[model samples]
Target: MSQEQRLEEQMLSQEAERRLSEQLDGAEKIDVDVQTDLLKIFQGQADGVSVTGQGLVMRGIRVQDIKLQTDSVAVNPLSAIFGQVELNHPINSTARIVLTETDINHALTSDFVRSKMQNFELNVEGEIVCLQPQEIQIHLLANGKIGFTGKVLLKEKGNARPVSFTAQVCPRTKHKPIMLENFNCTQGEGISLEVVVALMQKVKQLVNLPYFEFDDVVLRVKNMEVQKGTVTLLVDAHVRQIPASASNS
Candidate 1:
């Protein structure tokens, strides 16, 4: 080949490589943004009392430290604009209930009562356990006795009825908070429970974060268990894409 022709070909190849590099960089940025948004949503949704005082605390898997491959992005067109992502880290979290006598009474009388059951009332004290990653177990004292009572009553001193439940997390909206769907107690013939939405809303309002929403991404609980007085959950979250305009804002 002529010298001039060889030089021209080299320049064209370099230009193509530069354009590809820029595209890859842009895709990575989008991936990071999506992951960051998901973490924010998780933190926001996690702000609530499962029992009282100490609620949920999400840890590990820093957003900035998350890494994504360019090839993963290339496979999905939406990922090119938003970023293809996967979270394989152990999600560590804690939920503890430490309340004063007054606080405990208020929680029992107001929050624990259901509108349908007027006669249903009881005092409870205990620690949450998360030794297993599939469910949250609770060993509490009912009326100072070891037991838990609800639609089904199981009571015994120092041998309280153990309550356990699993979580099903999902995204309810774009760039919003996630929801724990069908949280059912799997002990004493099993019973489904619902989180107090009003309380959650109040907690969110108190935080007053501007860009927070509800259920921005979907999550599947891979492992969950309780140890001592804390419940820990390991989850895999699926972060969906947010519109470019909305994300920018």
Candidate 2:
């Protein structure tokens, strides 16, 4: 490649890395590599792109580490000249995402995730009950099982009480819902079996969602593996566009 072409390529790669870093809430490290040639650039195409990050937190969701590589990408040439990557077509990629036990627990308590678990209404024995989660923790166990312990505040008919429970979660395929193997009250009064089953069913529904969609990206997990202290997910990602930088937004 000519010196001018090499200089342009370097500039594009730098811009890509900068934009990617800006899209995250926080990260310990981030690297972006854009592969393209002058010919491909003029055609508004990239050979491929690879991204790797550690301690990435995006939209309040924490990820321990991630590696993603995309196929040929289509973008706008005009936008590329101005250091902006505007996609003209969606790009498909394979992603390997890793989360540690601590990452899982932190995400469980994060505002983004806790909002979905807190102050939910459940119908129990012909009575409307409100449930608020507190002190949730999860441990990645061996053999694809997760150990969970949590405290919850339950209100029924203006009466309130705290319940703490330990449970086992069995991870399954993407097509299937996670199974709640067992539940045992560790403190305070035991809850009704009916209420436990109802709560598990609600959790299963959330786990069985087809895909997770964000503003510019959609992800579907193809497989998951659980080992002691870590969980790894193989995922397919369809990205319509790179997320806009906070500064730009």
Write the residue-wise lDDT of candidate 2 on 51-87 in tens digits: 9999999767888989999999998988887776778
Measured over all alpha carbons after superposition, the RMSD of each candidate to the real structure, in angstroms, is 19.2, 2.8
Q: Please name the candidate that would achieve the greatest lDDT relative to the true structure.
A: 2
Candidate 1, lDDT over the whole model: 0.28
Worst 10 residues of 2 by lDDT: 199-208
Error of 1 at 103 (Å): 14
Candidate 2, residue 8: how far the Cα is off, in Å: 3.5
TM-score of 1: 0.22
For TM-score, the strongest prediction is 2
Q: How do the residues 63-144 of candidate 1 rate in per-residue lDDT, one tens digit apiece?
A: 1112211111101223322322212222222221232333223334432222222322222223221111122222322222
